[model samples]
Target chain A: MTPYDYRDLDPLIHSRIRLSILAILTSVEDAEFTYLRDQIKTTDGNLGAHLRKLEEAGYVRVSKSFVGRRPVTRYRTTEMGRGAFRDYVGRLEWILHSRPMDADQREAG
Target chain B: MSEANARQQAGDDLAVIRRLMEDARETVSNNGWHLVLWGSVLAVAEVFDYWAESGTLPVSPRVVWSTALGLGWGISIPLRRWSRKHAAVDSLANRILAAIWIGCGLGLMLLGFCGARTGTLPGPVTPGVMAIVIGTAFFASSSLCDRALFRMLAISWWALGSTMLIWPHPANNLVMSAGMVLFMAGPGFLLTRRAGKPARMELVA
Candidate 1:
């Protein structure tokens, strides 16, 4: 059995809201602020807080522009963010997949 | 948190993330009315041109085509506006698909105009060129989405286009008409029908 390491999980991407934002951004080119809020089912303030964290970590790029008279903010995952997401998800998958084997070994011992 | 409980929570979070990704991917679905509209219009125009060219119709082939083009524009302009207005969310895939078809449409129109001005477009090969243009768009769209059916449709179009190159003028139009109904309009209607239903999201394995 391989050793399980929780320390490998990224602290920045470990939270639910941040993970949700990354996951949603991964599947699309870019998404509007309202769209992300609606998809994540969070209050605007909360979504903004999480997005700010991600933006600080350089995991997302936020662009502000106007469509006619309305100002729009859109978020997209950066290349660095995509790499981090892949690694984060990969580690999570390994941990989840290895748990049953570790449990069986403990029982056999 | 205890180690075991923490591990369990991590697993749960991962599942939630996967589900969220799946749902996000499924949120944008195209109804494909544009495909049906253009396919039907083109098919009708081809058949009408054949009739006019074969001396069975009193009107010039140019008049028939002009009428078809005018009607196509009339319908397409409003429909596109309505679609943009009603769309719940715009995704990258939708934008790319629109660009592919619109670019192809403009390219074909330019080619046709050039050919007509130079008198280089023989009647027999018109369907062939149209088929190639439509096939290019289908191939591009199918590749973008990894849709096997549309890939097959693309191949079918190439084959139909090849047949058009060899077939005589009126007969080639008949072939194009049948091909449009069988390959183009048929799939379009199916896509529109499917889009009307609730999408069943499949989790990535």
Candidate 2:
């Protein structure tokens, strides 16, 4: 088998923004929508768009409720999503660890 | 609207949201953190009492680690997030309580390994008693952190430890260990499964 396979990997989470979203959700038991929004410093529309893509991929679960008068939303990672993230990170590590020797090393030899 | 006004409005909204989220998170459990803080103290003390009674641990090194697994499953795992929000103990109390428990464990372990007394027990009973006293103080001062159920396995540490203090027995440790595995760790295992589930409103309360 190949050392690394980026193929069939999640493009949605590949983006820096979505990656952070997954990272944060996976760390905590659960977090609120505004917490993610504030941390990511993204507009409501942008976050909503990214969340929709993740939700569609079944990587995140989102729920909404009302706290007294205000609407509330929360997000958390799925088991599959968590596993995929770990695998992605492992692949990244393998790539770095398995880099080919540079021209300088060849010349030195 | 002017940029200044927009900024002001956004700042106000941020403040409001932060408070709301904080409150929502807090509702995960009641003042249980205080109880947990006390519970840790109680755990350390219970360890000491075991030393005092046995002049040594009833179980071997492997058993001690296994018991810890059951205790954490029984007490620590289920209540961790609940403890995080309860804020029942002030920062001073938490650090002190945690320190006392950790110190008690390490101290006894050291005394035992060093063969300081060549006895069944390790460490001075005084330290363990002091830990219990401090823990009781914290427990008494704080209101119940959460519902009895919300506490899950942590309650057993308090109950079983106190029981051992009153009436010493090897059987009691069995009870304590059982309580930890059945009550504390069991729920935490279930919660871990849930943690991976998509965050939803129904789970918030």
Candidate 3:
């Protein structure tokens, strides 16, 4: 068996969509709203809802505007979010490692 | 029952799922400089073009350009908000960018306001001092962030301020252009490229 810390283990981070969101945020300095939407394949409301969750947690920040009459949006991760994610990944790896065989396994027929 | 319970209770598979999600998320995120860069480039170009075509001197030019930047800032907020739903704004990096966008937008607004009034703002010193002040603000803010790409952008602002204050180029916009190109766009383009390379790698791998 393995021991792990799950205090801030936001189940929000576990969702396939949100997890992907966090993952993408970790790689670059910042990203755009449209860029994230196209890659994740979720509807406008769906992605927005998840992002709002992240924002509430102080995991991400949002910025918006326009260029030549066209609108623009950008996103970036917070230091807290970054640190939390790294730790989450670390805990996940630790959790997945197989433990020593149980006594019953030694006697399997 | 003992062995089965032990294995099932561990729920190790959940961990695997999380890791996979992280990998997949990063593997997919990015829109490159296509949207924001093009917008910024066009906006800046428009301001430069107005200067070139009209040669209207102080009043109209600053008013027009500043108004334009103000509009740009207002527009960027919604654009950014909309993109979040699409997939681009779903990540951590992009979230931090929110503050940057706000800062830049506000800075542009301030610059625009100042520029609009600078003609009456008394001597060229006001404009120069304003440039230095705004430039210093951007430089300092960028410095506080740890990201290399951000630092590059800070240098660009610093260059613009220094050039205006010390070198005082009346005839050459090239110096400013070079500042954006070398410090802002150059590094931004490179970083965008750097970020995308990995997303493409899985396909090759």
Candidate 4:
């Protein structure tokens, strides 16, 4: 397969946990940190680190607030994040459908 | 990875994404108690009003309606608070559903109490308008959550409301009451039964 076929696949969203986070956020307006933690089935530290990475990349926006005495943190996908996810999925679909015959033909030549 | 393995991995990733999205959407549609509570309250009030108007009950219609509204609000507020506090996920769909129902309730209240007292809206037409408002809410909810049952409920409410509007009669109270039972309470009960308990998750330490 040519490098062009899969080159556009987003490296940041290709991981399982980050991909799952984006998928969940895409389905809802926002989600609590604990909800993401439970859904991803990952350790708090692991989820936090990945979230920080996504936040730094401007893919996720975080909001912190107090519910009574407890502090609550919520996350939402940024517009860029949504766009990236859509593009990532699109690339995956294209790669899955495209055959590697061009590379084979080049080898035969 | 081999081409076949890459394809299989891509397919698996898509499947996981689909499952998570479905799970998130499902959370917004699990609220059933709100419907059952309001339906029961309204049904009881309608029946009591019917009996009183027919001279079978000794209570005043005003007293019955007042108590019914009072009880419905009294329970609904706390229940809403509790649910909000306990919810694991709060989606836009949930917020939209709440807004729709709350708006419908307030609109009905203003029409029923203020409109009736001001001699603008006749008492006989109040129920029909209320049903139409409720049906509109059900329709919004059906569209939001993609529930066919809610669509059916919307149609049922519209049909009942139209009947009451077209044919003004004392027995319309009974018909409205039955609509509450069949469309509102029955669906609420079914939703409650169909709602699955939240799956227990094993957290990583």
Candidate 5:
């Protein structure tokens, strides 16, 4: 594979907003809608749009319920999402570490 | 973007993701007040039971334990209701923690009932078994939360539990009381204190 092949990254996941959502969701069991919006520092409209994209991709599952009579929404990553994220991270790491050693640094030894 | 620039951005993105994951993990709080409340109640009961057995009180030692258990249930029911009302999200970590404590509580209750029926459990043996159960719960929770403090507490419980098994009478009861304070109530309070603070960002090396 070509070194640092940015084109190879998953279009759905490579976007900054989606990546942030996946990153947060994968870390916990689940999180509320307000919590995600607050942490990602995005408008409700923007986050809802991105979350919809991720949900359509089957990377996230959203459930709605009531908490003390108020509607509550929570999000969690699916098994498929977790696997895809792991692969994405692995590819990124491989790209970063596979860079050839600098000639100057080699010569310094 | 050029290969060099692509690599740079990739590394930066990875770092940001790592930081976010760490923060999210930290936010998965386990309500520790339950542990603290139960531990305090049980410790008091144990001490009072010991005192009553020593002829310091005119009442039966059973009265102290029954009263303590009744008070514990009364207080815990309201505390649990309040927490549930305030909680907006029911996360997986919380569920796992709840399951662990619930299983432990059920097991203890079963053990007590069976022992009472069969007359197999001695007073000194009860504390040792309890310590082992508490230690197991702490160990599991520590691994799940990635916290070293709970692991250390688990070890403490195991060691203290073994000692309690070997000792008898007032000494065993005292050790059990001390164990509740140090391992359960102490960590519970620590969790409460830490809850108010913002999670620190951890970056990948």
Candidate 6:
């Protein structure tokens, strides 16, 4: 109903791709770069960019290792990211449920 | 934004989270090769031990078990390395599952070899102790993965172990062998079958 009510929603996690990435990471302990790309149905470059944004925000942690000769990258959500996601979801729920009350108040006023 | 648009966006976001979480759980739970391999090996070893105990086989029980356990470890170590190298994802559930089973294996080795040789654990009651340890592992695994099948197996192992401990008869060897085949190998085969079906369908597609 007002900008103040939506202030708690994280802009970084508001985008569809970033939201999807967080959702996937929250579900599993860790996931490989290729796994996330395939699940999100995005190109490597696009996925990598979103991942980097989240990494810079300290919302995700990446680990690099070698499986024989080939290098592998894995990602997981950090504690801060988990907390932010929870707050975002809680705020979203509040917004969804409080809209009717706000509408009723506006009509009365 | 309009109320209708905001509501739609919220619904879509929640749906995406729900669907992806379910998919991740399904993918992580599909692994069953280690269970199948270990179950088959243990089942065969228990059966051979039963035969030797019954005088149906002339070989010593000690020799049969040692060779069987040795062979199991020899194969399992390499197999685990290969699986870890090839795994597409490393989940917390998988790690906990591996740790539970690895700890179970070490407990069995200590009870079977060290405890027995040192006379700290009597030879006759060793199987019962091992069974209890296996049951505990299965219980832990069931709790971790939320699988009813593992809980049932845990109960079965506990019952078998209790029965052997109470009776303490020579014929319990045959009973233990039967328990291994029915409980361990049977579930292993079922898990392997379920895990393989998706791969086969993918190949066909």
**Model 4 Cα displacement at B120 (Å)?**
4.9
Candidate 3 stretches with Cα past 4 Å from truth are A1-109, B1-59, B115-146, B172-174, B186-195, B198-205
Report the lDDT tens digits of candidate 6 across residue range B30-108: 4467777777788788778778878899998789888988888898889878876766666788778888989999889
Best by DockQ: 4
lDDT of each residue in A22-97, candidate 6, tens digit only: 8778878888898777777777898899999999999999999998899999999999988988887776765566
- Give residue B43's error in model 2 in angstroms: 20
Point out the worst 10-residue segment of candidate 6 chain B by lDDT.
B196-205
Lowest lDDT block of 10, candidate 2 chain B: B196-205
Pick by TM-score: which candidate is best?
Answer: 5
Candidate 1 vs 6: which has more DockQ: 6
Candidate number with greatest lDDT: 4
Give the alpha carbon lDDT tens digit for every residue of B1-205 in model 3. 2434434533543444345445444432243343345345534644463465357445454555555555655665566655555443244444544564566556655654565466543322333444444345445444333244455455556656666666544333444445545554555465456554423211100
Q: How close is candidate 2 to the true structure, as a TM-score?
A: 0.37
- What would the TM-score be for candidate 4 when compared with the true structure? 0.77
Model 5 Cα displacement at B199 (Å)? 3.6
lDDT of 5 by residue, B33-62 (tens): 888998899888778877886888788866
lDDT of 3 by residue, A18-103 (tens): 76667767765567776566656667788888899988999988888664586777777899888877776665554445344423
- lDDT tens string, model 1, B6-94? 56866887877877776666554463788788889878977887888898888987788778778877887788777754554456787
Off by over 4 Å in 4: A1-7, A37-58, A61-74, A78-80, A93-109, B1-12, B118-121, B193-205
Ten contiguous residues minimizing lDDT sum, candidate 2 chain A? A1-10
Model 5 chain B worst lDDT run, 10 consecutive residues: B196-205
| Candidate 5, Cα interface RMSD | 5.1
Clashes of each: 0, 13, 36, 0, 0, 0
